[model samples]
Structure formats: structure tokens, C-alpha cells
Target: MFTLFYVLSLAIACSAVSVDVSDATNRIANGAVAANLQFPYAVSIQRIANNTQVSTRGHRCGGALVTLQHVLTAASCMFEWNADGTRTPITIGNYRVFAGAYLLSNDTATERVRNIAQYVVHPNYLGIPSYVGDLAVVTLSTAFASSTATPLSLPANNYNPADFTDCVVAGWGAATAASQTGANVEQKYANKYIYNQQECTSVYNALQGLPNILPTMVCAVSYDIVSSSCHGDEGNALVCGNTLTGILALHSNCAATSYPEIYTRVSNYTDWVRPIVSLANSFTSGASVLLLLTLIQMTFANLLS
Candidate 1:
């Protein structure tokens, strides 16, 4: 069983990517409060403890709205490994997603909260130290109202990472690298530049001696040291222009001079996402009909057997 404590400890230790590192530059750490509705697709994911419906303090991560009833996030956000190396999946009842929420501490009429009905983690995702395909789709119990939250557009099938030189990342993640606190309730954003894969790999390899940066990942470096996502920013959206191009995956050192933040390339997995989102939308629009049809099919198959 993966307890809340275990996940929290891992979050604190990893700081949303890897173990926290000490850095002295404050200029390189400047994330500013996002403008209201600046990121309409942004959503805050709260992990409940003991199957409770209420949001547990300090159990939150960031995610992006992909469809009315679907969200895109990191697979690690929804699953963890047990003490015996067995995988423990988080229950749908343990999650609540808040859309159009700028400050979680304050209640706003504009905010739309929904319980998770189900989730699908990428089949290729393994675990830490090898976060290859760290992606997941979360299906909400109810669809978000269009007035409350608008889904962000996914990248084109032939979207080139090179064309996205100016990218913006938004989340309710920590404000600074040294702060061991949970994510800030206020939304924050920073501008970053996409880095060449080779250049990104060189920096990580030299700093951590781990060449884990894969082609499936997208890399970006902050224009300034203070403009990067730190711990609690995992699963946040990396938007280029109006499209979601990446999902926060890992980082070597938050706001460090040489290290760059890595994200799961959203473009690489569009093939996988399209089918899931289609099914989710269909299920949402015709729940009773689909359920009846599924039951009838199962009955017929059973009789034939």
C-alpha cells in the first residue's frame, strides 16, 4: 500500500524531478503570479487520503485540461511503487481536480471541481530513475463547464519543437528551490526557451552523471535563473504559443545556471491520447447508453460462451 506519507516524502525529496540541490542565485529563481485566467487550461490536482473527498493539505500537483472530461498529467502523479517493488495505483476516489483555480486557499465561484472517475497511465511508464513515458490521462466524473475552463489545444501531429522557441510554463508549484513547503495556492508562470536535446543531455550528464534524457522528452531552459518550475510543478503544462507542447517531467536543479528542466513531449504521444480522449468524451456524453450497450454485449458474449 502506498500511503500518503510515502508519496509526500517522495515529493519532498524529488522536488518534482530529482533530489533537491543547493544553489545561491536568487535572480535565476523568479516566477511571477499568473494573470487571472491567463492559463485557463491549468488545473490543480489534489490527492485525498483514506478515501476522503476533501482536499488534503499539502497533497497537490499541477495538471492541464485537455478535454471537457479529461486531463493530462504525469503518470508518476497517479501511481507509486510499494516497499516490495510492487506498483500501487492510486484510487479514483483519492483525487479531486480543480479547474479555473488561481488560488486554492480562496473559494471562487469561477472554480470548478470534479472527482476523478478513472485514469489511464501510459503502458511504457516504469518508475523513477527511468521516467521514460511519464504520461497519464485522468477522466473526470463530470465535465467542466465551458465558461469555467477551456481546454488547451494539443500540438499538431507534425509540430516541431524547434518552432517553439518561446514557451511558457504555469503551475501552482513552489516559489523557490529552497522552500520545502507544499505548492503555493496562487498560480505562477515563467518563460523558457527550448533547448537542443544534445545540449540538454550534456548538462545533465555532466551534473548528475545520468544520461536519462531521452528523445521522447522535451527540454527547456529558463531565460533567467529565477524563471523555472521547482518542486510541486510536476505535470504542469508547458505551452508554446496557444498549444500545450510539454508536460513537466523532471529537472536536474531548479533555476540552476547550467541545468535545464525536462518535460514529456506532448507531441510524441498524441497518437496515444487521441483514442483515450475520444472514448472519454463518448462515455461522458452517452453514459447511460454506453453502459447499457456494454452490459448487453457482455451478456450476449457470456451466453455464446
Candidate 2:
């Protein structure tokens, strides 16, 4: 089982404000501060030093809460590539998840912090240059209280990507490509339009010399060049009408003038995800059984004494 920890005195003072969803959708460039409770399913995957206090630093990636105890993200976020082009899984000790976090600088009392119990990456995923099957499920040590946050639903098997044009991507990643120094303290979000896969493939192949966009990937472009997901946004969610549609994969260049961003098509892998989620629940069930057995053993010992 994983252990939970807390970071104290990090909350900042900020007034909650309201935003019009339509206006937000039409806006262009650099994204905007997300409204409080705007994205209850968004989560921050943070990396902390061993034996150190939790700080605002070390945010590794972003993800979406897909179940009470599971977060969906890119498999690349959980592994490191070596000089020899081989990959190694990252240790669980270096990470934690913060759910219902609107502002990292101002973590509210309701936000939930959880340690990762275990994670499963797609079997076909290899490192860079070929990010096919780039998805993973992060199981939390403990489930989040229902009152604290609700999990986002995955797209149905019959769901068609072309039917949804307006979409939103949210994360604590760099707000702009020009400023990649630090991630936003508060969650930032922007609107993007799903683009034709052929057009997206043409752009990437011509510019970056990369392979054609795979069937397992989806492409989206910002209304303009200035607003797009950048560094630190990896593994974030591409949500359409509250349904998780994709996982952030790659972009030609952060806020590029021509290239569109690529995401792992979640709709294409519902079969792979559903079973892993069921497996995650078994971990919780096993933990409960162990606890009960320990309690009963203690009770019998006391009776003999």
C-alpha cells in the first residue's frame, strides 16, 4: 500500500470569480486562469524528493481522474528514456497526485492528495520517435471522497471524434511557449478545435519529418497560434463536453504557428482501460481483506490472554 502526505502553508489568497463558458470558448492566445471547480477531474502529477517536505516544485505531468482511484495519463510520464534508447519505469516513491486542484499556489481545504499505489502502461508503448499506445493508468493509494471530486467519464465505444468540434484542454503547464521556465501555479485552460487527421498528418510530416499520425492519436489546433498546450502539459486531459476524449501526447512546437497538437485517442482504447480500472479496485479489496485479518488475529490474541 502507498502512504499519503501533505504540504502545509502553500495556499495563497485569491477571490473566486465566474466565467462565461461561451466567452471562454471564443477567446484566443495564452489561455486563461480556470474558474474554481471548473475542472474537478483534472489532476497534477507531482514529483517530490525523497524524505523531503512537499513543495510547489517538481510537477512532472498532468492527468484526468477517470475513476474513484485511477488517473489517466501518458505512459511517457511514468518512464524515463536512457542514452541507449531503452526505457525504465519510474519508481513510485517520487510521485503524488493532487486532485481538484484549481490553483497549485492556493490549495483549498477540499483538494485531495494521494500517493500512487501502482501504475500500468500500455504494452505497445515504446519511447520517443514513436509514441504509439501512449497511455497509462495511475492507481491511487486511497480513493478520493465523493464529496471532494467526481471522476470524469470516458467516451463511449460508438462515440465519433468528428461530432465534437469544441474542446478544452486543462493543466498547470507552461502558459506560453515563450515562457517555459516555470509552470502556472493556477490551472490554465484553453479552447481548441478538432482538426482533420489528414491535415494534421501533413503538417507534422512536412515540418518535423515525423511519421503519420496514428489511428490511436487525435489532433487538435488552437483557434490561433498563441494558445496551445506546451511543456509540462504532458499527460493532461483533452475534454469535450465533460467526457475525456484524449491524453496529451505531443506538439510540433509549443504554440507553433502551423503544427497542431497530438493526443492519444482515448475512445480507441476503452477496452484496454476498462479492465485495468477493474484491476485497480481489486487492490483496494485486497487491502481491506488484509486489514480485517489483522484485526481478527488481534482479537483472538486478546481472548487467549
Q: Tens digits of per-residue lDDT for model 2 on 1-305?
A: 01111001001100110111101111113777788768888887877546552432456788899997999998888875465556678788777788765766544343478889889999988657667898999999899888777888878866656833888988776544344233336778878778788766655554332445887889886765567665667788988767788998774234334346789999988889998898667647566868878999999999999
Tens digit per residue, CA lDDT, model 1, 3-44: 333233333434434432111112113577777788889887
User: Once superposed on the true structure, which residue ranges of model 1 sit more than 4 Å away at CA?
Assistant: 1-29, 49-59, 80-87, 107-111, 177-184, 205-211, 252-255, 285-305
TM-score, model 1 to reference: 0.79
| Model 2 segments more than 4 A misplaced | 1-29, 51-56, 82-86, 107-111, 176-184, 207-209, 256-258, 285-305
Q: Which pairs of residues collide in model 1?
A: 15-231, 28-225, 28-226, 29-225, 29-226, 30-226
Cα lDDT, all candidates: 0.70, 0.69
Model 1 Cα RMSD, 1 decimal? 8.1
Best by TM-score: 1
Clashing pairs in model 2, backbone N/Cα/C closer than 3 A: none
Q: Which predicted model would earn the best lDDT?
A: 1
Task: Report the C-alpha displacement of residue 135, candidate 1, in angstroms.
Answer: 0.3
